[model samples]
Target chain A: MQKVFEKPQALSDTPFAYCPGCLHSVVHRMIAEVIDELGVLDRTIGICPVGCSVFMYEYMECDMIEAAHGRAPAVATGVKRMLPDSVVFTYQGDGDLASIGTAEIVHAAARGEKISVIFINNGTYGMTGGQMAPTTLIGQKSSTCPGGRDAAAAGYPIRVCEMLATLDGPSYITRVAPVDPVGLTKTKMAIKKAFRNQVDGKGFSLVEVLSNCPTQWKMTPVESLSWIDENVVPYFQPGVFADR
Target chain B: MTTKKILMKGNEAVVRGAIAAGCRGFFGYPITPQNEVPEYMSVLMPQAGGVFLQAESEVAAINMVYGAASTGARVMTSSSSPGISLKQEGISYIAACELPAVIVNVQRGGPGLGNIAPGQADYFQAVKGGGHGDYKLLTLAPWSVSECFYLTALAFDLADRYRNPAMVLSDAIVGQMIEPVELPDKIEVNIPPKPWATTGRKGRGKNVINSLWISPDQMEEVNRRLQAKYTLAMEREVRYQELAVEDADLVLVAYGSVARICRTAVDLARSERLSVGLFRPIGLFPFPTLPIQWLAECGKRFLVVEMSHGQMVEDVRLAVNGRAEVIFYGRSGGVVPTPTEILDRIRKTYGRSAGVSHYRLNPGPEARR
Candidate 1:
């Protein structure tokens, strides 16, 4: 009998505790798969943030460090600097990357820190009971913004890839959505490329993953996928903003 | 081998000491009273084949220290009072994760950006778990430039030995003052094996450096383990310098730069025919409580002098346990008390005359008012 597919060797047997229909498990799988494909599982270290995927280390087979809320980039920088030969990356969410940790992330990119960043922009704060995130849409309703996010009051959703693309430090900056089969394929490819860039000694590669939080969006998993295509995709255009 | 002595600022000695102690990574921000630390590290760290990064902020710098230390590398970060406050969050995480790192607080005046001169006001913030949560840093207080060089190396050893963060709680005067430091050209630092470090876990099971224990029972277990480690440190690492405390009627309790002044005041008090001694706590966290208690049992009075409005006095009072009178004389807002002023305070308290003993005495039941 031929074995067609199996779990990535870099992924552990631990079951994910993510909410049903969340894309965190998918992204985690992609990152693990990339590590296996690169054959750097033994030399790969991960930094997980204080978000829905805070336990991302439990699922990854490589050595991992859990950073404080929004400090994953700084932690990754430290790890990468100490172990220059090892592949280092940080897994963070919109809130973790754009809000409280904005200074850390921006400076990390500006310093041209040689590390990969996997950013999940799920529109709302999924773990914290659907609070308004920095990437929340103008009309999006969250626990904090009960009446929908007002652009004037809450400011605008941050386009991290676009913002980072403006800096010369980053070698690669891209946005990808995994709401469907085709999008999922591209998301995985982007994640792999981001990791590959780090392995090649390229500096500050980031892949912003446009994901849907079904529970937080107050919709079925299927409905949330469609909601992302209709509402989220247009605001956050999916493409490589920088690749150099 | 004969070790040569060099005249260097306390800030430069800290950098030199870290390098000598096998510190391979240093992440810091430029702040006054301690800027020279990062400045010296910037040139010396790379020369020593180490990493010296001027982080964007103190928060990022400490988190960087966390990341570097998680890999079992001897890493450090130095900042002043305001900057140290910014680092409290990362410090808490480092403590909780049991990461071995050295943090230097070359303290300056501050409740909020008070001034850039020297200050010992951060004593509470350092020894009392400045960050949220129940944790302790092996805090070392150096009274002179020579001690600054040596205690930093000791801090790295102790931090790694216990797998806990160690703080070099220095003041601006000690950080800036240039004095002769008799140090070996290259110290042979013996870093213990760190099987827990996250160094890619080659050919072994995956290693995870984390502080978050989701289950309450698990969290309690983690805290119990940390507390046990702290207890061991307290037993094995209590360091203090006692001068003339045996027959002295009044013993002055102090640390850091204030201790140096107290040392002079102790000499001056003895010259003035008063039996005053000095008890300088070298390790602030594992504070020399036993010695203070022993002194209190011998019916000795205490006068705690600090650069702040009385922070370490509380610890001294706790050690005394109301067994004897504990007086506190402090000067805040970057005012370094001269030996004469401390000597005068000592005379006022020890002489027991009714001639205006303005310093607060007996930090217990009747002294609350």
Candidate 2:
């Protein structure tokens, strides 16, 4: 009998170290699958951030570099400039990309650096225990904002896709979620497009995945998926915000 | 065949030296006293088929250096004192990852945006690991424009030899001064093979350039390996210059631009029939400690002069270790000492032993009883 499914060749035998029910495992697989499908595993370089996905270098079969917290964009710029023929990408979280590393990401996009970015918007700081992030929604409860996020105190959530779309450097910018079968397919397609843009030398491309953090959200896996559809999808508005 | 000597500023020499040493990537931010480096690199780097990027901030510039270095590329970044302070985080990460790169710090007055004048106040920061954790940058202090070009080239070889960061710790006076320098011929660039770099794995296994050793036992092992590399450097890489030190009654210790001023002071003292000598340390990190200790053992008193309040004096004191007297004279906030001021200090120091007499010579009461 022919095998129906198997692990992507771009992934290693080492198991992922992500927390239970975290969508990072799903996104990691999607990125690995894209790398395999494009047959660019030999020339792909991945930059891992300092959040929950910091250990991604251990799971991915390609060459990897672990960037300092929030500096993945800058690191990717360095790598891509040195090896223009290689495919470079960064895997960053909400706290890593939207908060501490805001300057790095913005300038990288503005420079139109030829790189692909996989941004995970889980609405909380999953690595350091659920703390407030720049993407944390208003009236959403986190450890820092125990009562709820207040507009006066914490401000509103930042829509990264919309914010980056204003820049003229990016070739493609989209938002997607991997909540269900249909959602997973769309998210995978968006991720593949971002990588393809870089391979085609079109310049910077980013796909923001509105991921789930069941451990930090204080809900079961099934409940978190429903909460994303009712709450996150409406505010974030998943769609292609920029494609040039 | 010999290359013609050309007149250029010390900052321009840094760029030329880096290019000659096969450095193809330079990321820097504009700051005073060292802005000429990035300005010259912008025009010359691309001409040399290299990458020159003006990063948004000093922090980003150093991280870009980290990324390029991870790819086994000859990369560098230059900044002044304040900008270098912002780069400490990335420098620490680069050090932890054991990546080979060169960083130029044309130090100015500090403590907080003090001024844009020459200062040696960063001696402690450069030699004692400016960033967090226990690490050493193979620091080279150049006193003249010619030395700036030569040492900058040497820094790359030393960095690649040990797979550690090397620093060209210059001062504003040296960075801005213009002098004639004989650049190297355009020979073949011999970059060592980097088997561990994060270039595409190709036919080999995956390569990971990282510093995160979460396990305590593994982290300790990495630290031990780093220490071993530093110890080897200290043994073989200490560079210094000693003029008339063997027969002199007093030795003056200095580095960078201050050492140039001290050299003139030594000459004036010698003309006045005073037995004063100059001992200039070119390698500041592996610090020429044994020579200073040997001089002290031979009954030579030391006068440590600097542009800071007194930073390198601590290392001098440690080397002397109660065997001889160590006097410190310094100026801060960009106030550079003139040759006349140094000669006056040398006269006063030679007249009597009014400096730190070494605790062993006059011990304090035990337990203040």
* TM-scores, all models, native as reference: 0.96, 0.96
Residue B264 alpha-carbon offset, candidate 2, angstroms: 0.7
Q: Among all windows of ten consecutive residues in candidate 1 chain A, which has the lowest summed lDDT? A: A171-180
Q: What CAPRI class is candidate 2?
A: high
**Candidate 2: true interface contacts recovered:** 0.78
Superposed Cα deviation of residue A244, candidate 2 (Å) = 1.3
Superposed Cα RMSD, model 2: 4.8
Off by over 4 Å in 1: B1-3, B353-369
Where model 2 places Cα greater than 4 Å from the true spot, the runs are: B1-3, B187-189, B353-369
Candidate 2 has an lDDT of 0.91
| Reference-based TM-score, model 1 | 0.96
Q: Is the docking of candidate 1 incorrect, acceptable, medium or high quality?
A: high
Query: C-alpha displacement of B262 in model 2, angstroms?
Result: 0.4
Can you write out model 1's per-residue Cα lDDT over B1-369, one digit (the tens) per residue? 347777889999898889999999999999998999999999999999999999999999999999999999999999999999999999999999999999999999877988998899998889989998889999999988878888999999999999999999998999999897787788778999999999997979999999989899999998898899889998999999999888788899989888888999999878765678889999999888888999999988899999999899998999999999999999998989999888878766644632424322433212321
Interface residue Cα RMSD of candidate 2 after superposition: 0.6
